[model samples]
Every structure is written in structure tokens, then in C-alpha cells.
Target: MGRLEIKSYEKIKEFLSEEHVGRIASIDENGYPQIIPMNFAFVNDSIYMHSYTRGEKLDNILRNPKTGFEVDRELEFLPSYFSHPTDASQADTLYISVVIKGKAVIVEDDDEKTLALNGLMKKYQPEGNYIPIKNNDLVLDEVAVIKIVPESIKGKYKIGQHLRTDSRLVLAKKILKRNSPTSRQTLKVMGFEETPDGLKMVDEPVW
Candidate 1:
């Protein structure tokens, strides 16, 4: 496993699309760091979130637009017991994560706000039962739409990427035996595939 750096924009976008919530970090008036989880939508190479027109987050953003955001999806836990019963400290969790360093700005344009809000609705409620958002909608004025334009975006996915070919095969078998949905996903992330003979590593492991 090399450094866990996800450099592909498409891969990061795919992971962002699957995730629902992201944590936004800001500096408060006292210069203390404050982090809040928000329902967010990633579109047009930016992150969008909605909040009350007035609040601590809004206040913080007004004072300083610079922000840090992160999103993560956990895969499975690997217990030390699987390798050595006595090495409890060796246990670790596998996961995919994305982090963003950006500047947050309140969207002043009604059209952009409508687009951002609609993107949120599509992400949270893809069934399409809700009414479309309009510029004249009463709720539009009451809610604040924040857009985060990323200065830097990074992603990391850890799933036995450092293991040797034989070791990865053994882990893949174990994951399959576990037969959980996450375990299945773990196999895919490890780039394992089923062949007529046995399991095969289709892609190079990514850390």
C-alpha cells in the first residue's frame, strides 16, 4: 500500500454522490474549532448545504468563509484476533473518506439557490414526490444556501491494499464467508473478482 491519496476526480465524485452527510468545520468567535454534520449535495464541482437564515454556522461563515469538510463511509472492522488472538492493538477499521478545504459563501442568486436546493432534494428524496423549488417560494428567503468551492479535495480508501496477492486472496475468502453486504463491498473495493478457477485481483490495490 502506498500513500492513501485518491487523485481521480471521477472516483471522488462517485463516492461523494453515495454519501448523504458531511461534517463542516469552522472557526468560532473565540477561535475554537466547531464542527457540525450537515445534509449536503455535491454538484458542479462544489458542495451545497442548507441551513436556517440565522445561526452560529451562518455567523461563523460570515466572519470567515474558509471551511473544512469531510465525508466517510465505513467498510468493516478487522480484528487482531483474525491474525493473532493476543494482539488486540492490531485491530483496525477499513473505510473510504474524502476531505475538502474550501471557502463557503452564501448563495445570493435565486437561480443558483434553487438549483442547489433542488439538488439537495434529489439526493435526499429521489422519489420525486415533493414540489419543485422556485425563486419566489417563501421558504427560499427564510433558508440560507451555502456553497463551498473547493480549494483542495482529497480522498482515501483503505481495504487491505498493502497485502500481498496471496494474503489478499485469503482475506477475500474470509470476507465472502462473512456474507454481509459490507463485506461484499469490501471485496469489490479490494478489486477481487470471481473466476472459473478461483478469486482474482482485477485492479491494483489502492490505499
Candidate 2:
């Protein structure tokens, strides 16, 4: 019934690893937030991303090292009608997210740069069709690898975990009938399983 925190480091890492992209925020010269969607790899307790040697985001990071990074998945949207027909205030959404407050630096060391680039490749191209990055690779000169060292990491998720059993059962049935792309997975995370009889709460909530 309280705010559920994802206390499992493994689960947090797994979520970050599987997420396709994350948004990084930096303070611009004018003190406005500049947020960019980036392809990144979570490795060594840090976030690594590659960019052009020159860019607004890179410039912002260089000027102001404090940064924020976030990754989230919107699983399902519960209609207001699920709880109330016309009140329209009972709607809720299910989601999982990780937020980070960190310091960013442009990696200058070739060895660490190589490792970060290779880590990015392993995440984006897991099929193993390309060569591993090397310290002396020519492309390293053209690309800038930004490494974010997190000062704080917070993970949170909501998937009907706070509802009473009767309320949750009703919600699960509605979600199943809605049958959105993520409905089944959402139900599973909420600990529901389909059975010959009907929907059953067979396990504890995963997130």
C-alpha cells in the first residue's frame, strides 16, 4: 500500500539492460534543461553513451557535469471506466522506471573509452555480428563517449500491487479483456496467471 521501491539491484539492472533507450538531462548555458534520448549501456555501475565529438548535449555536459538520466516503460493504461463510469478520476497507469542523479564526463582515456564503446555495442548489437572495439580504433577519435557516474539511483514500479484482492481481481479481469499488447505481461507482473478455471493470483508481484 506504500510507494513500492525496487530494492533489488539485480532487477534494477535487468530493467535498465533491457530498456531500449533512456533520456539524459543536462543544464544548458542558459540554465535550461536539455534532454536527449540516447542509446546507452548500463555497465560497471555507470551509464555509457556515444555521441559526436561536438554537440549541444556534449557541450552542456562539459559546462555542467550534473546530469539526470531516466528510463521507463509504460505498461498499461487503466480506463476511468474500470473504476468509475463518469467520474473520470479513477484512471491509473502501470509502469516501471529508474531515475538517476549523476555526474558526467567525456571519457579521455583510450582504454576506458574502448571498454565503454564495446559495452554499448554489446547492448545495441547483441547478435555478435561486428568486431569488438579496440583502443586504437580510428572511430574513437571521431566519437565522444560520455560516462555518467551515478550518485543516486531510484527504481519504482506500479502494477496493481497496492489494491485489495477483490479490487485487484476485478482490475485483472478488465485488463485481460482489454487485451493490449502489454496486458498479459502486466498481469503477470501483478502476479496473475491464466488457468483452466479463471484468472488466479498464483505468485507475488514481480516488481
Best by lDDT: 2
* Per-model TM against the reference: 0.90, 0.94
Report, for every candidate in turn, its global Cα lDDT versus the true structure: 0.87, 0.92
lDDT of each residue in 1-207, candidate 2, tens digit only: 245688788989999999989999999999999999999999999999999999999999989999999999998999999888897888889889999999999999999999999998898889999989899989899899999999999999888777788888999999999999999998988889999999999987655
Output the worst ten-in-a-row residue range by lDDT, candidate 2.
1-10
18-130 in candidate 1: lDDT tens per residue?
89989999889999889999999998999999999889988899999999999998888876766777989888777899999999999999999999999999999999999
Candidate 2 regions with alpha-carbon error over 4 angstroms? none
lDDT of 1: 0.87
Best by TM-score: 2
Error of 2 at 96 (Å): 0.7
